[model samples]
Target: MTHAIPNVLTIAGSDSGGGAGIQADLKAFSALGAYGASVITALTAQNTRGVTAIHTPDPGFVTAQLDAVFDDIRIDAVKIGMLANAQIARAVADALRRYQPKHIVLDTVMISKSNHALLAPDAVAAVRDELLPLASLVTPNLPEAAALLGEAAVTDEAGMIRQGEALRALGAQAVLMKGGHLAASDSPDWLIQEHGTLRLGGPRVPVKNTHGTGCTLSSSIAALVAQRDDLASAVAEAKVYLTGALQASDQLEVGSGVGPVHHFYRWW
Candidate 1:
């Protein structure tokens, strides 16, 4: 008898640049040895420089895709990103309740690297109220966390820890608050759980080719969780994988602008 490979589903927008969103998630899933599937909520005409245009798919279509994937595939985990609007967010929340995947890793993507709003301002509450509670783990960068909390932006390591706890209080089952925006010496992600807390640290690769780091990290976590039994172990494993990917990102000269993390085959 052949054993089935673990499956991870990515529900997000398509980055025409191929560095972020559904593309990045699928790459992370496959690199980690999981079968990858996707449900695209929007289409982004974007590149390494910036997002130029966005087209949101109909909410009904999003629901149909969700149903099709859930009905046929034995999805072990779902990594959610870039729900174009509140309608799409509600559809995703409802599907998660219905199909009940074993793990949900939500990357609450808000803004892009070149300072474009990815999620509509009207949709913030839907993500917080509707989608957040369903998440087994929600990975929010500094700005996204502050937006969800409806508070001033987190500015420091101390602020990251505090807001991470605050976001957990806001109904996420678990929280991973990233300090990527912090002007600190190192990039640290504070993981807040029910039993305890952990500060997962990594070398801040001083490279401009980090276009998909957030999506990559969250999907890596989802992929690892799908293949493992422990949440802490998954987070730890993801941290290692992401740090290496970031370091290797500079190795790939994909675009004239900011490039992407190499879906590396070797460990240096």
Candidate 2:
């Protein structure tokens, strides 16, 4: 029997460098053989070095973009990233509640690798209150996790798990605590669920072209989950894909500072 292609929607910002946000999300969706759609929430004059300026559209226009996509396309899953402020977060949350997609991967993006602040400080509460409950999974790196929980960034694996649990308590059905910030030989991530926590470990790729890693991974999982894979399996597969992208990242010379992973490494 012929099967329809899975449709994945990414609600994110625009990256002029094309290494992250909506650009990275669509690349990941295509790499995973899913149809990708996007609703841009903000625009950034960004490069690998840093963000020079950011322009946020009104929240009503964000809602309009959501309406435009939901009205026509069959969105199987959604990957959310880079809500610029409280109003946009609430607006996106309202749209998600109305559409009720099967899988929603919330990437709690607060800061860029270049140390540029992406989410407003006042928006953290809105993310916890409105977006967390609607998310199937929330992927937060150490700092983002701590900011969400109103605690210090964790130093060890145990602290990561604790923060993950606390985030789950805040209403995210599951939490993927990313441990890339930790100083270790291997990169580890904990997937905390209602039943138990899963440890995903992989060797850290020694490459500087690691821009947009979070966006790529979350969108990959959303695409796989849209194809009907279980959450754990999808996470595992996405991890492997990310590892490969990181391993091959050096091949692409995209920018002066940090660069993007090879989204089409398998093909190219």
Candidate 3:
């Protein structure tokens, strides 16, 4: 019998539309040739339109799921997103401390694609205090970076670099400040920190299917890191993958609103 591939685990919320959150993370891992596992933190009544309701799973249950996966599976990397409350945040942090996985990619998912808040105000502090420090890399879009640092805006590349360095000080070994939602420019996303900074700009591809871009990007980075890619290389590859996915997204219509990027863009 053939042996199974190494696994990557995602601890995140469930997106009913299958566009983002755990769904997108798992898909990205699979498309990138890694086995995927998940411990769901919350369930959102979400679709392409927006999130109508959110139900956080019991923290104990969340913990149990993590224990089950870590105790048996060989999780080479872990991607974290959308822990809706302080308890869930603490629960996830506790699991990470116990497992000490090789890589922890934190996608600070503060708001949904439709502009709905996915995280609570108090939970932001929990994420900053408990979670960010534990991350190998934290991938935050402009708004999330601003929220994490209590800044009003991260309006430009220089601001992103400053916020990225500040996030590094908060405990992340590195930071990938996404430039997608930043002021429009010809630049690719910027990855910055005290160690170094790399501008990952590619030709901007116009597409409406971007609901899962952040989840897919972070998970792709985790997958590459699991396979021994250095921080800069992994991020670069992830950017290429995301751009292709976005460019190919013109053909897919997963929902009425913003659809999902094609995780298997390379395949088809």
lDDT of 1 by residue, 44-123 (tens): 99999889999998999999999999999888999999998999999999999999987999999998888899998889
TM-score of 1: 0.96
| lDDT tens digits by residue: candidate 2, 11-85 | 999999999999999999999999999999999999988899999999999999999999999889999999999
State the weakest 10-residue window (summed lDDT) of model 1: 259-268
Error of 3 at 257 (Å): 1.3
Estimate every model's Cα lDDT from 0 to 1. 0.89, 0.94, 0.88
Candidates in order, TM-scores: namely 0.96, 0.98, 0.96
Q: What is the lDDT, from 0 to 100, of the residue 191 in candidate 3?
A: 79
Give me the runs in candidate 1 sitting further than 4 Å from their true place. 1-4, 265-268
Judged by lDDT, which candidate is best? 2
Ordered by TM-score, highest first, the candidates read 2, 1, 3
What are the runs in model 2 whose C-alpha is more than 4 Å off? 1-3
Q: Clashes per prediction?
A: 0, 0, 1
Cα RMSD of all models vs. native, in order, equals 1.8, 1.2, 2.1
Candidate 1 residue 209 Cα shift, in angstroms, is 0.6
Regarding TM-score, does 2 or 3 come out ahead? 2
Model 3 lDDT tens row, 1-268: 0334668999999999998999999999998878899999999999988999999989999999999999999888899999999999999999999999988999999899888999999999999999999999999988888889998777888888888899899988889888877657554577776668888887667777888988999999988778754778888888889888998997786878888998887887
| Weakest 10 consecutive residues of candidate 3 by summed lDDT | 1-10
